[model samples]
Target: MTAPKANAMKKTTKPAGAVRPKLAQEGFFGRSGYFFARALANLRQNVFVSVVTVGTISLALLIAALFLLVYVNLEGLANGWSDKVQITAYFDKEPAPLAVAALKTTVKSIPGTKSVTFISKQEAESRLRARLKGQESLLEGVNADVLPASLEIRLDREHRDNFAVTHYVAALKKVQGIGEVQYGEEWVQRFNTFMNFFRLMGLLLGSFLTIAVLFIVSNTIKLTIYARKEELELLSLVGATRFFIKAPFLIEGVLQGALGALLSLLALAGCYFAFLHNAGSFLGVNPAGAGLSFLSPLHLAVILGGGVLLGFIGSLTSLRRFVNV
Candidate 1:
């Protein structure tokens, strides 16, 4: 009996060194791997729910991306038009090269001025002729000197507002070489009004769309959680912490968002390519000349981030509503 008891003790008393490998294997990374595997299994087992969730996310992101593309392009076009709304200050006389150079420097030194380009009389005439198109023959007897040499001053973004432009015009009139200042006051005011309205509408519309997407994603994710009710209940019964129970769902949400965003991007690229291919006939300009542009990398990143956040929030909201944990 003593010998038998000793053997039993030896069998039960494994060395500390022998137990360490098991502990190490079940550390943070190991647990994370388990959660990851479980999440993937959940996704695979509920194929219909996963597809529906992904599809819903993809559709939402697509709509968002389309609106984003429109907003970006409209903003770009508005900025371009604003840059073209220059202040043309005519020179009283044909100044020497040094005088022209000095005037250019002076114009550039102004606080709101983006750039100053001196347009010689000849270049001005050429521009007029180009504008005239076939009517240029009507000006056969007109002298080039009738046109004025001017400094075209483009304003910086902050200074493109009506009040700023008015102030800049007043300041330019006081400069020594400026014979006359010309800018369309009414036109500037109208442009500013349109820009303000455009921005306001974009903001309201974007907010509505974003909320709609969030709701759709939340509902879709709720379905996914409902499908895994048994698994979640079993985990909870087994003393799994709330964070541990919720983490896999959060990861699933993020995965859905990331994949959805990628799908949207790919779809957008296809549309862009299609647009380029058909742009000439539809828009009267080829892609190169159409002034169409895709979103910048920074903008794309923002879209991806927005999708991820939307997913995370949707998942959190759904879980709170449905799972009780």
Candidate 2:
């Protein structure tokens, strides 16, 4: 009898692991479909609260995403402008052509320097004429001989920081025949300061918004659990496993969060399109030339993942307290 009992125990335990793989291979689509249907039924049962919770989440996510989008674009613009940042070292007088070439080689060899191009006095004069556009008469007395022959230096991205650039400028100014090293000092400094401020603000705002959404979702889920307390008690009395009892609520939470994220994305897209259609030129963002990207595919994936995580957490929190009670 003992041997048979032990054999039967092994038979039961062996199928447990094997059954899990088979069930998993069956895929989640059927389970997900059932969960979605149950979630919709729950939402319909608690229409007012569900709408309020979803609306709150949507508004919060939309605002956060908008700010994030703005921050990303601003950072990209700043990086682009920084890459174009070059130091023009003007010569005190017209140096020999060979000397200019030597100076260009020296500048190119400097640490952090990506490229150095020699700007001849004649080229500089022509550029000035083009810039002035029909005001060439004003530069009639300005001869190429007097115009400075400079070396325009491009720095690598790693050395694009203001302090590094400033130190490089100081060193470059000591080079022979180089009189003044000019760059957008004030503009770069101002941009760095502004970007820092925006980053701090984004952090604070994102934190507060995340907390607010979490609280709202958790409370909503709590109320939902409370409403179905009697049914849950009945399930518990019937010896239903905890997993079975909690599965539906967890699924509902995930559905709520995912739906809210998707709705928010749609609403933001609509707003963006409307703005572009009406005020594309006014906004200074070209409609045709690299139109605004709302979110990258990676960011969209993160949003969906975040929604599912938040939903799961809220459901778990609510169920924990309600089940214990």
Every model's TM-score: 0.81, 0.75
How many pairs of residues in model 2 come into backbone collision?
0
- How displaced is residue 273 in candidate 2, in Å? 0.9
Overall lDDT per candidate, in order of appearance: 0.82, 0.75
Residue range 1-325, candidate 1, lDDT tens digits: 6999999999999887765444424434668887787778877887888788888888898888889887877787687778767889999986777799888888888899988889999999999999999997888998789998999888999998888999999889888978889888889999999999999999999999988988888888887788777877888888877777877787778877888888888888788777734654586644344446787899789878877886788778777765555
Worst 10 residues of 1 by lDDT: 19-28
Residue pairs in clash, model 1: none
After superposition, candidate 2 runs with Cα above 4 Å error: 1-52, 77-84, 92-115, 156-158, 174-177, 276-280, 284-292
